[model samples]
Target: MAWAAWLVLWALWALRGWSCLRCDPGSMQLLQELTGPYLSRQLRGDPGLRERLEALLQRSIEGLAELPIGLPSYMGVIDEKTMGEAAAHFRRAVTRIMENDYKDGQLFNEMMWSLQALRESFTSLMARFQREVFCPNKCGHMVHQFIDCRACRTEIYSCNRGLYCGERRLQVQEDDDLILDCALSWHRASYGAKSYRFYRARGNSEEVMVTSPDAFLLKKEVTANDSGRYRCEMLNTKGWVCSELRFQVTVTPLPGNSTPLPMPPLLGPLTLPPSSHPTPLGGPGDWTVWIIIGSSAGLVLLLIGGCAWLFRRQREVPKEDQDSPGGQLNT
Candidate 1:
């Protein structure tokens, strides 16, 4: 588990760098053209040459930003409007470069106003890339649940009941997975520092669907048995409940069935009741699938550490030669 945490840290670090550049696989070369030294000191001084070059560059930045696969790794939604603005600036920069070009091809020279403009544009685009483009965390979104979840993670602040509180009533068909979010932040400090526990109220007892070890609340292949009042709580590291979210799940029948099943018990408070049973977060959770990526980082770190140790060992003098000068036995 310690290794796992370290691996998680490493993958997260690596992801930070990978996310800085968000060009699509098909657009890498185009990105390089925009950011690279296409504006070199050397180019044909012919009158039509710069225009042709500008035209080519303009084509490169026209449809620059494709929809990036948004996953909420940093735990917030991408700013689409800002992202669009970035792509716009990306287009504007090259246009500026072309407009400011000279016979000398010195587009990036200090006196070039367009050079600064281009730089500023790319800087803005780069910031968007970090915050929205490659962010890795998943968020609890209220939009079209199937399509909207893929984009960057987003924190829910509006459209819910209270500032930090929200309730979602879902009418999911049978056999559909029931997924709920327990990572609600009631205050500034309560979001990431807590673990989530999920429960479904039975007759007199509430069965533990998911416990504190997992951050996600999920019951896969949910059937009629799974339909019940669901409560999710966020607990601090010390195992004290800190925040809660209520979910009302109505499991509708599959196609061809007209009548709807009974609704689950009423939604409960986000906070826990006085008496409760705590259970281990079971099934390794779906998050284990993602942690597999961290193992590769672990192996790479181990290899680097092993190599460093061997190199340092080779540089050391043998302990048996402690008395010998220059780490060599006389004669």
Candidate 2:
């Protein structure tokens, strides 16, 4: 914020004037007696006083040296740390004057009182700056869900994620009636925007029209007619305190009759042999089909070779039996 920088510059100027005033020979002599040897010797003369004051002021400026460029509208650039540090400096000055006494009692009292006032002013300013600038009192966040279907209107639902305004702090309440308001705004680009409230209550006994009286969900499906900014207001039991937030939602209806998405083209027609069905890939000429045929042919050849080898061995065994011994003719 440019205002923060301006405030810091003004503070530096004021501190410079104060330091110069304290550098006067008469004033320094009084401080010499009040603060003792350390402050008098180490922080003597106008230059030394200015240097010490500048060092204190520099602590705050250095803390906020990195300023963001083009910060978002929802975000703030105020430097809270710098303000806190400046407030601390004011408080310390107050303490220094109050802790010691000097020869001129009236002057010492007056200086202490002035420092006290400055300390209080800076402390209050820091708090107010943080509240109004850094932490804005606005509504919380909103989350919306859109359902896709072909109908008269699209189904939409949204919820308020927060209630209070301070940065991330929740505003807690009990037995509160939440009043929701919806307004329609057309022509998103135009500077002239018209908004109309959804339902307004007239009598004390009359109730506001809501999709759900208990929950935050909209009672009816949001149609194209329900496009605009929506704000929710919460009222306490006594109707004394109220909290509110604003959100925008748009609902677009699909055509009554829509064409289906086209299916992907097939590689080729699937065909199979009369005895076997098609493979898992919807075709018989796949790598899996070839692997199955090769394995079956190898098994059939192995079975035939085993049977022929066994038959040849059986015939040779009978002939070997007849050749053995002296033979049947000798018997």
Candidate 3:
């Protein structure tokens, strides 16, 4: 019974035609048409080119199909003889291109154009593939495109044609609302009429909305809980273009009650202390100290002289000598 179930599952997978999980069959077919021949040729002569082309193809396949296929692993599945035949075809094509001696500038421009086309084609393919792989019955139902917030690791979704496009970062405080602003511009060389859509996803919830007129801005205000991924899409007569910017919304906690720290005063150059200067032994300040010493000494000398005069006046010997001399003269 288990074997029967397994076989049935395998059959179902095979019936899916090994398509990519995120790409449409038509877009994938276009990619194969555009890149397959060149890639096959590169695989034959230049081993390095072969490796690079294989890696790119593998990345495209993984991005579109969500398959666990690697270049070496896939090569092992192919027979040696088949690989040789493919290589030979690629080598011949490369040889012809080299012989043509295409001008460098022209070749560069052509390559650029081809790469741009490839990118657009791959995006459509991936979108279709995702729809098929995830929502088989609801193919026409709107699917929310997911953009990742680089800051908070949140995944947000928005409508296909909304206003939030080309936003880089968003921040909100807890219990406070935050507003998001997004603006978009297109390359002037794009000649087709363009339209856009926006998407935002938070947690498991997603939202999608169409954008307003061209050259317009989108503003969205939501609380901290609304933080998530935001992105936008551009569509025109040519096809669809997506904004490369992934806006991340982060919600932070509010600050508690605290005074603002004051800035320190700016200090000028340091001045040397007056005492640090070498003082002359007989400088002006030294002379002042000496003058005070000299004045104190003179005051002491005057006090000593007054004291001696007072002591002499207090003595009786001077009066006796005067009386004796007068008596002798009279006799």
Candidate with the greatest lDDT versus the true structure: 1
Residue 329 CA displacement from its true place in model 3, Å: 94
lDDT, residue 110, model 1: 24
- Cα lDDT tens digits for candidate 2, 197-282: 22323334323343222324333444444444444444323332234434444445454635888765577776643656544664
Q: Roughly what TM-score does model 2 have, to 2 decimal places?
A: 0.23
Clashes of each: 13, 1, 33
Q: How many backbone clashes can be found in candidate 3?
A: 33
lDDT for each candidate structure: 0.49, 0.40, 0.45
Report the number of the highest-TM-score candidate.
1
RMSD of 3: 20.5
Better of 1 and 3 by lDDT: 1
lDDT of 3 by residue, 1-331 (tens): 2332332333234312222221233434544543466545533445564455445554544443333444322211222233233334333433444444343344334444433443444344344434432222211112232322112122323223332233578677767655444333322223335555566775687577556435333444445566678665555454445333456878776679347887555797766556877778888988899999999999999999999998997796777777885656643
Put down candidate 1 lDDT per residue, 82-199, tens digits, no spaces. Answer: 4455445545554555455443424324224443454456455546544533322233321211112223344333222222245678777898897786654332222335567787
Q: After best superposition, candidate 2 residue 304: deviation in angstroms?
A: 56
Give the lDDT ranking, best first. Answer: 1, 3, 2
TM-score, candidate 3, is 0.23
